[model samples]
Structures are given as C-alpha cells and as structure tokens.
Target: MALPKEYVNQMRELLGEEAEDFLASYAEPKKTAIRLNGLKIESTGFGEKEAVDKPSAGQSFVAGRDPVPWAAGAYYTDKTERPGKHPYYYAGLYYIQEPSAMLPAELLDPQPGQRVLDLCAAPGGKSTQLAAKLRGTGLLVTNDLATERTKALAKNIERAGIGCAVVTNESPAKLAAAFGATFDRVLVDAPCSGEGMFRKDEDMVRQWDADAPARYAAMQDEIMLEAAKMVAPGGRLAYSTCTFSPVENEGTIARFLAAHPDFEIVATESPAAWGFAPGRPEWLTPEEAAALGPDRTARLADTIRLWPHRVRGEGHFAALLERAAPSGMAVSGASPESEPAGAAAAESRKAGGKTGGASFKDPKPGKRTTAVRRGAEAAGRGRSKGFDDRTGGESDTIARYEAFLRESLPGWKPPGTIRIKGDHVYAVSEPAGSMQGLRLVREGWLLGLSTRHRFEPSQALAMGLKPHQAALSLQLAGESEDAIRYLKGETLQPEPAKVTGLNGEPADKRGWTLVCLDGCPLGWGRWDGATLKNELLPGWRQV
Candidate 1:
C-alpha cells in the first residue's frame, strides 16, 4: 500500500517522529462501529429484558458490545458480524458509522426543541445523530447540494423514526438567504480531500494528488461563510472534516475567524482525554501562520484531531464554533431574528394569505410544476379537523385520513400540519411558505397517501411509531421465522391471540396493524379476520 510520496513527505514534516507509526497504522484492519438509535431504544441495555426468547445464548443483536469510549450509545463491532443484515438493522435500531465520524455531532450536542441544521447532510449519518438528540422535539432541516443524494438522506431520517425533519436539496447560499440566522445549532461537515480516509479506503489513496487539500480548502471556506449566516445569535456551529490537511482544518478556521468577528472558537477539554490530539497550529506554513497572525493561530489549538494511530478508528478533525449573542441577550433565549417555536404564528409575506411563509418555489424553473399550493394553516387547522374540504382533492380525502388515524393510530396526532400534496399527505412542521423558493425533497414527515377514497399509511409512518402507539400491533420475535417472512413482504396467517389492541381494546383481527420485530416497529400490515396482509414498502422489503 503505497501512499502518495508528496503526502508522505508532508506528513513526515508535520508529524516528525510519529510519521512512521501513522503510516504503518494504515495496514491494520479498519474499525467498524454502530451508534444505537435513541429514538428506537431506551438505553444500551434494552435487549436484556427480552433475553428469554433468544435462539441461543447471547443471540440478541446487541448481545455483546465493545463501546466507543468518547461517544455514548456507540459501539465497536467487528466486520464479520454483518450487523447490517440483522432484522434489528431494518428496524432502525442502530446506525453503522465510523467511530471517529461520530465526534462532531456529539460535540455539537443539539438539544431537544432547538432547531438544527446539517448543511452538507448527504447520506445523513451526522444529521440522524443530531435528530436523535432532538428526540422528536424540534425541527431538523437537513440539506445537501447534490440533488440525487437526498434520496438516501430522506430514507435514513424516516428509518430512524425522526418525525420533525425537513429534507432539502439546495445550495448553502440559497438556504442562508431564506433561513437567515434561524437555527439554534448548525453543522458543516465539510467535504475534504479524503486524506484522513486513506487508511480506511484505498480508493482515496489512489485519488490523492498534491493539490487536493488547497482545492478543497477554498470550497470549505466558502461553505463556512454561508453556514455562518444561518446560525442564530448565541447559537453554536461545528465544523469538521475527514482530512488531516492543515490548509483545510486550521487554515480554514483561521480565515473564517478573520472574516467573522461576531464568532469565536470555544475552548474544549484536553483532546487526549477523549483519545484525540489537539489541532496543530505548527503544521501551517510560515506564510499561512503569518496570514492568520499570532492570536488566532494560538487559538487554533482548541480544535481536535482523531488520528488513525492514536484512536481506535479512522482519522478526523472537528472544531466547535459559536456566534456571539447580542448585548443583554440571554444565551438560551431566542434572538429577535430567530423564528419562534412552532413558527405557526408568523404571518406569511406572500399575498392572499398563504401559510408557513411563502409559496413553494421550485429551485429549478418548470420543475415540480404541479406542486400543490396549500399553506401550513391548511395543514394545521383544516386537515387536523379531518375535514379539509378546501384543497379540492377527493371530497372525503380528509375524512378517510381521519378515519385511519382514529382507528389505527388512536392517540397519536401527526405533529405538524397535515398537508395534502397531490395524492401524498405530509405532516409538515413549517408552513409551506416557510420553505418558499427552496428546492424541497421532503416537506416534513410523510404521513401517507390519500388515494381516491382511502388513506394508505406510509412505511415512513409505520417506522416512526411505537408498538403501543397503534390501536393494533403484531409483535414478532427478532429471530422468529415470522419476522423474516414479514420482512420479505410475505403475508401471514396468525393465531387471533397474536394480534393485540391498545389499552385493553379487544383484538378484532382486522384493520391496519403496526408490525414489529422484538417490539421495534418494522412496518405495517392489515389483518382481515383470516390473514395478515403485509403492507411493508416494496423497496424496503428484504430481498
């Protein structure tokens, strides 16, 4: 495994006596890990109570775990275990991630009920982590500039049972313009030269060039500037990268600090305490250091680096940044520019009384031409009443939706406005106008579809609910034949006793049933006296 000579030389110059060990560490097996989803499980010991049904001793998905020390709920798993193939994986019990990649979101520490953003959130690992911290309490607006990557991003959000997410596919500049310092916390996990990943992915080594860092540094700086604009006053921002490049890490911070006077780097505990190394201001060239000046250069040490040789995982870098609060403002209080919680009270600037804040403006002209024009007010008021006669779909669309909720999900109300767009129904957090003019992927939580006369609940809705949340539920042992059959999209003929209703209601063996694997909601099924028809999303069905 030959590294780029230029890169080796550079590392040697920067790491000195540590360079040999750092380069040799690449030959070792890459670490594999998973972060347990808090939205899905209560604690690390969740499977212990259900241990009786195990196919064999220690057969639980989390039976034996080697936890990642720096991150709670994250554990190191071996590659041979193939955790991805487990039924629990389909149930969204955990997320497969590199241990080092988990640090940024852990450091950002988004709280419940605070609006958060993952600016470069493609493939959504960090975004999902932040959403778990929110615990279904606040809005999570995750965006990626690449139009195609958002498909996976949306799937991951839904899979994790996250209901308060708004998925967007747009440029950072456009989002900054529309949101305007509205988020309580922001994460810009900037794309880099993949220098840090060279050990884990040989492809990155093949693709490396001498100029990669400088090229990516320019983009990272620009992205940071736009991301800075979206942070609320006194809000926190985290910048991170997978590359060990000084130009992309410390250099980018130095440049950003020089430009943005209202922001400062918050000091953190000693990096070694968390199996990390402090940022190296000494790595920057003399000219680069002079450009940053003495004060900011010294402050750069507050950032952290996770080296492949020093940590149990791959290499990564992360820095916490905070925007200064206005004079006399409390850190926890909302700033004047901040959008209020629920944001339903804010009047739309659009004419003729639209809700949210603006009409859906397609980022591209002539695309989404048939986009529905309902406001958040319609979703919040008319639809929730189960009689939204205004949107002009089928006359009984809302009636059907209401009936489903009452019968299947008796006590659970979709958190946001129930907006009907075409045949699709969404429980949207912000009014349609709030995201006006941005390219939208998913408006909010996709509740289901409103067909001609019936409301078909979506796989997303099923994944987002718990077993008790539904009126009727079918619980399958994680290793039972029934579980795999259901996951394969096969119908089942179960004993009437297997079907149970919420709060002592009689199990009639009819209507929609939330299907689960070991009490973890997998999807939905409809039981018709004799057979349980699988309603699992076809795309999600195990092959």
Candidate 2:
C-alpha cells in the first residue's frame, strides 16, 4: 500500500506529524459492513434490552451494541460469519455496503414527497437510501449507463421497498431529454478511478496511475453537466466518488461550478463534530487549499472525505451543490417525455383507448364473479364512473373500459369479456376469482392496500423470510409459524397467511393485509383463497 508522492506531500503539508502515521496504516482495504433497513424492521428497537427480553424474541447482533450515533445503526465487525446466510439478510432487512459510502445520502437529506434523481445509480446503494429517505412518496428516477447493471440496480431498489420510482438504462443525454429540470434533488455518485476503493479491492491499486484521476475527472464533468440540467431551481445535488484524487474531487466540482455559474458550493460541518475524523485531501491548487485556512488544510475542507486510516471506514468523498434560482427565466412545469414508440402505444392502449379489437379480451367465463365484483367495487370507489358507456360496442366500449381499468388497476390484466367504447376500455373479470388478491408491485415490494386502499407495512415484503416458519421464529400454539416468522423479519415459506387488520381489526377475511410486529409496521401480504401469499416489500427485500 504505497501512497503517491504527491498525496504524501499534500498530507505532510496538511497534517505535519500525523501524515506519515496515517499513510502507513492502510495495509489493506477494510472489509464491508451490513446495515439493517430500518424501514422493514425497527433498527432502533433491535438491540434494546426490552426487545431482547421478550420470551419469544431472538437476539439481534445490532441489539445492545453501542453504534456510532452519527452513523446510526452502523458498526464494524469481523467478517468471519457469512452475512448472506443471516435470516435478517434474507428478509432484506439490511444491505451490505461500504461504511464510508453512506455519507452522501445523509448529507443530501432527502425527504418524503420530493422528486429525486440518482444520475449514475447502479447496484443502487445510495439510490435505495434516498428512496428510504423519501419514504415511498413522490418519484425517484434512478439511471445507469450500463443496461446489465441497470437491471441489478432496479432489483436492489425493489428489494429496498421503494415505490414510485422509475429505473432507466440510458445515457445522461437521454435522461436529460426525458426528465429535464424536474427533480427536487439529484445525486451524482459518479463513476471514478477506484483510488479510494484500493483498500477494498487491491486490483484497483495495480491499475491506478497519475493519469487515471484526470481521465475520470473528464467523465465526471460531463455527468455533472447532465446532472445540472435535471436539477430543478433551488434544488440540491450531491457529487461523490470513491477515489482519492483531487482531480476527481474538488477539481471536478470546481470545473462544474465554473461552467454552471448558477450553482454554488455549500459548506458542510466536519464529520469529526459528529464523532468521525476529517477525511483525506485530494491534491488541490495552492490557492484553493489556502482558502480552507489554518484550522483545516484538506483541499476539500468544505466537502467531506472519509479515510479508512483515520475514520475506521472506507475512503470516500462528497460535496453538496445547490442550484440557484433561474435568472431571467420563467419557471414552468416540466413533464417527462412519453415512453419509446411501441411501448407508448401499448401503454396508451392499456390506458383504455381503442387501438383495435385485438387488444381487448374477456377473461374466461364462469370462473367466479365474487372476486371480479370485489376488484370492481374497489376500483369504482377509488375513481369516478362517468367514463362508462351504455352501448356495448366491443372495440369502442372496451377501449374506454380499458382506460378506466388502467387507472383503477395499475397492473390489472384486462379480461377478454370487456368491451371498448369510443375512448375508453371497459373490462370485467369474467371469472372474477382470477383477479382476486392482485398485489401491487412497485420497486420489488408487494403493496398491501388497506380497506381504505392505503398501503400498509408487512414483513412478507422482505426476501430473507424462511422457507418455513420453523427456521425463523418460535411458533405459537395453533397459529401458523410462517405468518409469525414473516412479521418477525425471519425466513419463512413462500406461503403467507391472509389476515385482516387495517385499523387493527381481527385477522380474518382478506384481500391484502399489512403485517406488523409489536404494533410496528413491516410490509404487506396478499391472501388468495385459503392461503396468504408473500409480496416482498420494495426496499425491504434487498437484504
């Protein structure tokens, strides 16, 4: 683990006596950590004495451990145990991530009901955190350049229990055209030369060189430009990288600021004040470094950097930028462009415009009308019936019916018996049972609708539940261990129990119900006939 001559000199100039000691300690990159998803399970309650005291409850590693208050629920432990085998991991109650990498999302401070974009999201670590911060409200668009990686990113987002998000595999240009100036916040967790990741992945060191930083800095510039276009006026953006090059850190930001005069760098407090040490300094121009003053000489004193040698975590960098109000420009609404040609047509047809009779189909007859009626009743209650037509014109009538169906049932598959009206598509589940207990799939979580059609939480949404309750929790006499296990954030059989309790009613008769433990919400479940089915909650399933 040899430090670059320039990096050593910069550190010596900055830290003096501490420089050599700090640089010598990085014998190797530190191992990664896994943090439980608090949205799925109450992480704060996990290690509490009262929680562990329960006769039926099992012990959680995070429980009773004194975590770094600033890094809530974060801890460093030996990786001797296989984390993937843990029940909580299987349930998507946590995610394996680099400890230092968590800083950017915390700094960005995402809130519910605010639209956000992750410009270079992939494998979705920070993006999922942003989703959790959003609390499933508003919209999150996560984009990645590599198509294959985007699929994995989407899966991670789904596992994290995110709803109201759009995942795209596209370049910055395409995203800019599709959704310019619409996000309240944008995250540019840009791709970079893996300097900071050297400790975690030694191969990165072998490939590292003086030119790598400059090369990545170029790409970072372009990515930041596209990111700027997507940020709404007064919105905030966080730029981060897992590299230790000033060219990729402050230099990149400086270039961006120079190009986009409407944006300004906002200073942030030290992680030290929050119980962590100040991070490494990427090389900076003498003037820029001087501006930080005598107390702090790290080139990025205004930004945050986490060095494993100093902070007991991986190395990373983050800077917060806020877009100033547009000058001499009228603020106007921005709508995302429609989907690609064929997909758009299909979507429109699904929305209920008659494309052709070929598009309409009635479900098999005599299957059962009760479930059909239930779905219809739920849909009717949620929407107006003014779109219905009296005349039963197949194409015209079904078109209108389909449109209504699309709105009422976002994921419903229209039955063949439905007819098309002028601009609407109408459909009834011929064998209504087929539509019974349809689960809402967003991200990857199965959304349980309350009797009032509101979403509630349940544990069935996590991926780590046991194949059978026996592997997860202590079974209460006469109750299905599987159901109890799912709520406990343990592994369980795919079959979940259908229970009723929106306002805490007796668990019976079911369409879907949110499962909870000790009154805390977990995720949602769907009941089909006599069986309760698991709809893994998004975000919570990414264990």
Candidate 3:
C-alpha cells in the first residue's frame, strides 16, 4: 500500500528518526483481539460485584493466547480467527477490537457503580469495555452524532449483557447541556483523520490529504468544548484518537486546557512504562502554544501515544484530564480502592477463565416454558432488529411480559427494573435521563417482546442467561458437530434419555428451551416431539 505523502510527511516530522520504524510497521500484519465481558460472567456468590476468575463453561473458550497490554481480559487472537462467525460471539463472551483501540477506555478506568459517558461511541468497542468496567453497577450513557451508527452501538452493549447503559444519537452540545457535569468518567474517543487506519482500511488512504487533519482538529475542538461541560468536578475526562497528527492530538488538548483552566492534564497510565512513548507537546510550535499558553506545551508530556512500530497495533493516543473546579455535576461510582483493576487493566485481568458457547447438556424438561397468549389491541412485532422506535411500554404490555417472564424464567429475577415500549420490554438498572427528543437507541436491558398475543425473548437476553435460569434448556459441548450445527441454525434431535424430556418423554411434548454450548446460552429454540428448531438469528448464524 502506498502511504499518503502528506500524512507520511506529517508523521515523519512528528516521529523524527523513529518515523522509518513507524512507517515500516504497516508491512507487518495487524494484531486482532477480544476483551472478555466481565459483567456477563458469574459474580462472586458472596453478595459482591467481583467476577469469578473462571467461566463455568470451562477453558476451551480461551484456547488461544497473547494478551493485550492495556485492555484487561483482552487477548490478541489469530488474524484469521473470525470470532464473529462463532456462537460465543453471539453469546457476547467478548468484543473483537484492535489492540491499540482498547487503550483509551482502559485508561479511563471507570469503576463498578459510577455514572459514565462515551461522547463519541459507535460500533461500540470502547462503550462495551466501559460496560465491563462498570460491572453492571452504574449508569453508562454512550452517544454518537448519527442515529444509524448508534444501532450497532446499542446491539454490542445489549449483547454484552449491559443493562445500565442508555445509547443515544445526539450531538455533544445537546448532551452536555442536558447532562451538565453529571458523569464521574467521560471518554472522548474523537473521530480523526484515519492516519492510523490506512493499513487496516485502504479507503482511508484514498480519503486522506494534508487538509484532513486540520479539518478534524477544528471539529475536535467543537466536540471537546461540549465534552468538557459534562465532566463532574473531580471527575476524569479521557480523550483519545487514532491519528498520529499533532494538530489533532496535542494541539487539541492544548487548546482545551487553555480554554478551560479549571481542567488540567493529569498523568495517565503510560504504555511507555512498558516501552511505548508519550505524546509530544514539543511537536507544536511556539505560535501554537501562544494560544494555549507556554505551560500547556510542557504538560502535553502527560498524555500517551501508541505507535504501531512500538506496539503490535495501529496508532492511537490518549490523554487523561481532571476537572479541578467544583461544578456539582460530579457523580460517584465505586471508590477508587474498590475498582476491579487499574488504568493498565491488563496486569490484573483474570487469566485462563473459561467462556460460554456451544452447550451440549440437554436440560431435563420438567416444567413447560409456555407463555399464555394475552388479548390486547396490537399483536405487534418487536424491534427484533435492535434499533427500537419507542412503541411497547404500555400497562397491558408490562403485565403480559411479566407473565411470560414467570413462565420462561421461573425464579430468576431480572437484572434491571422493567419498563415497556411498543412491543419491547426493558429492565433498566439505573435512573435514566429524560432524553425526550434525542434518539435513544437503547434505554435499558431489552428483556424481550410482548405483543398483544405473543411474548418472545430476545437474542441479547439469551446471551446473559444460564442453563438453569430457563424453564427448559439444551446444553452442548465445545467444538462438537452438534454445537456447530445448532449455531448454523440447523435443527437436531436430542437423545431422549440423556436429557429428561418434559411430560414423560422426548417425543411426548414440545416447548421453548434455552439453547446452550457448554454452559453458555446461544439463544432460544423450540422443541417439537423429536427435533429442536433453531432459533439462532439468521444474521448471527455461523454458516
């Protein structure tokens, strides 16, 4: 791939002698990875939020190795390992992300119970990590300017079993005005000139020009102004970018600190401590510092940058800033002492933990998992596609949903408080903002659908459940042909004697059961006499 001349020139100056080494990194294959979902894992039975070190499904899930240095529970997978094609991916066991892309969220270090926000979340890599950091204890509101992208963000969050999040499609200015220093931790993974993505996405090279960085720098300033407003006093605001441009990385931070003196750059966990380099304020000329002041340039050293040559990933930059002035918008999460891991969460990530996927243990069908058909005005279809349009939360809908829950889940209490919209039902774990006009992609835990006549659970809801949680369940072993068949949306017969069937025998009755691979719930499926119908979503099917 030919390097963009302007981009190369800019990086050449920014990197000095190291520029050659940095540019040469593009020749090496990029590192691929997945961060485990801490929230989706089993918690300590001792009534605390700490997750167990191992998965109940066993160790076959984490069969591969090479852990990322920043994101905890994240490991570099083989480049060809298309986890998206696996049942565990649909089960929300982990999120596939570029290694350097995981650094900023790790540096943010959100605790289990604090209110947080991701100012520019889309395709949800960082937001999911934030959800894992929160461990289902606090509110996390993630936003993107475009409503279309928020759909993917919402799915990734829900798929990862996060119920405390509210995904929104709105501008930073509107959110800042509405929130007003409300978050304990705020992340701005600003969109940049794609200098870092040239290798991974060749189109970025076609789009790049000398003018792109300056254009992005201007936009970053506008977005940063609003992001700063939403930071609570004493709260931390983490800013990051994938571009190597000084104008966007250092210059933008310099301008923000100068614009808001009450906000100061605080030293974040440095990958440099592990051999990566820090951000260079010296890259900015004296003229640039004139606007941000002289000290602003010196403080830039506090920020960190991940170079592709230095690390086994693409370029990325991160800066941690604290709002020193009291704005009263500060919300508290878990005390710092109780946070699960440090900014460099990799050091503390649990190693050798098992994962959920392809279960073979056929549930002993003792109880029937049938929801009674309720009479109502509209026997409608829920947002099975995941981009909700606010239609289901009526009183009748709630009642019907509860009835279904009782039948399907039995004694399992929902993780969040229930609320309905259209045919959709949600279990909200934290207090949500009014967000009246903003396009809210997801408000809480999307439990399932409840039309006038039928009630159906969601793929997202299935991922979080255990085999025992459902009234009926089918478990499969890891790497089994049956497991692959089930994930491929193929129906298969179960050995009648292996799993005790409901109503006397396997051929005697029919109902819905949670389909599992090992102990991980794949999704919902229906059984009819001799065969189990695949309920795995078409888009998510392995085949």
lDDT of 3 by residue, 1-543 (tens): 788787778678767898899888888887788777665444211111234574344334554466576656677789878888776676676788988888887777776567789989998999988876665566788889977787687777767766667778899988876778767789999989988898789899899888898899999999999998887677778899998888899989988887898887776546354456888888875767887877767889878888888887887888988777444433343555434332223222434232211111112211111111111100111145444433345776677677877766777777556666676777765543457677667666667876546566777777666666676777677667888888788987876443323332333445667877655667778776567878777755776
lDDT of each: 0.74, 0.52, 0.69
Error of 2 at 501 (Å): 6.9
Tens digits of per-residue lDDT for model 1, 218-335:
9999999999998888788899999989999988888898788787777766446446798988877787778767887887888889999899989899998788877776555332
- Of the two candidates 1 and 3, the one with more favorable TM-score, higher being better, is 1
Instruction: Provide the clashing-pair count of each candidate structure.
Output: 4, 62, 21
Better of 1 and 3 by lDDT: 1
Question: Best candidate, lDDT-wise?
Answer: 1
Which prediction has more favorable TM-score, 1 or 2?
1
Flag the better candidate by lDDT, 2 or 3: 3
Write down the RMSD of candidate 3 (Cα, Å).
9.4
Q: Write the per-residue lDDT of candidate 2 for residues 1-543, one digit (tens) a residue.
A: 765676567557766787666676577547566654534433223323333245223234553433333333454456575665554444355677787787787667654556677878888888766665544344666778877787667667645555445566678876776667767778999999877777777787677776777799999999988889988776778999997677788777766765776776666555364434443444556664555443434324567776666665667888877777656644322212212322322332231211110121112211100000111100100111232323444444434333433432235442223322232332221220121232211222222222222223223222212212111211222124553456444543342332433322333344443343332333444544354455443334333
Model 3 TM-score, 2 decimals: 0.84
TM-score winner among the candidates? Answer: 1
Candidate 1 regions exceeding 4 Å error are 43-59, 270-273, 333-394, 431-433, 504-506
State each model's C-alpha RMSD to the native.
10.4, 16.0, 9.4
